[model samples]
Target: MTEVFFYHLQSQPLEAALPTLVERSLERGWRAVVQMSSPERLSALDAHFWTFRDDSFLPHAPASEKGAADQPVLLTTDEQNLNGAAIRFLIDGALLPADSANYQRIVLMFDGNDDDAAAAARDQWKVAKAAGHTVTYWQQDPAGRWQQKA
Candidate 1:
């Protein structure tokens, strides 16, 4: 079953969400893919994953030459380096769907205020629901309280 996960960036710290998401994926033995805008944020996430010796991290490098379809795709917005991993596009509160064949669960991490990020997340949530995939939303209150709603 395909699963879509969304994190609403409310009052919660992004750091607090990573471990929870990581644990959930590990518990289910799922290949997780995360899409984000800031390279610094991605780097922080990579650092968080280091705590789990069993996890592997792939940072999107971005693709070179816009028309070159044969090259490896990277998610980085930096047009100069397009030779990384596949780019995961985010829209609002939705997450772009990954290749369902390779991944069982997808966790999208993004700032709630980012318009594109939120839209992508919402789109992914709809897609997952239509596909009968489980969907979960995690958000934080202004007080730094974490809340997970499905």
Candidate 2:
């Protein structure tokens, strides 16, 4: 069974939150596929990853990039895990994979302040639970720390 994690972003935006989470996934020696809501977002995230930190080098590239399967992180606009990633980072309310078993963990990050995003997360959480996946919700506390709420 795939472990589904809902990260409700309240204190940080996607640009501010994604890099660290992706980095952690890499630290654990797990490849990651990050799918954004739109192609525009995918391009933006590709640039964001390059410049997120001056000294940090996140081994990532766009899905269309050459030799993408060799990268530790791959950015795309769909559920296809180009890099054989065990972790899937779905940002901007992207849809979950129909067969989530392909991933060891699926992290859905949605903005808490966005009404549509919040509703989508809630709906997905219910669907994931009904499907027998282990679903956990983590909300950001006032201090910007993640606290598991459900």
Best by lDDT: 2
Backbone clash tally (model 1): 23
Q: How well is each residue in 1-55 modelled by candidate 1, as lDDT tens digits? A: 6455566776644565555554554455433334455666555555665553456
After best superposition, candidate 2 residue 88: deviation in angstroms?
A: 0.1
Q: How accurate locally, in lDDT, is each candidate?
A: 0.50, 0.89
Per-residue error at 14 for model 1, in Å?
Answer: 2.2
RMSD (Å) per prediction:
7.5, 1.0
TM-score of 2: 0.96
Q: What is the lDDT, from 0 to 100, of the residue 2 in candidate 1?
A: 48
TM-score of each: 0.50, 0.96
lDDT of 2: 0.89
- Give one digit per residue, the lDDT tens place, for model 2 in 1-150: 999999999998878788999999999999999988798888888888889999986889888888998999999887778789999998887888886888899999999888999999999989889889999999888878889998
User: Residue 112 in candidate 2 has what lDDT?
Assistant: 88
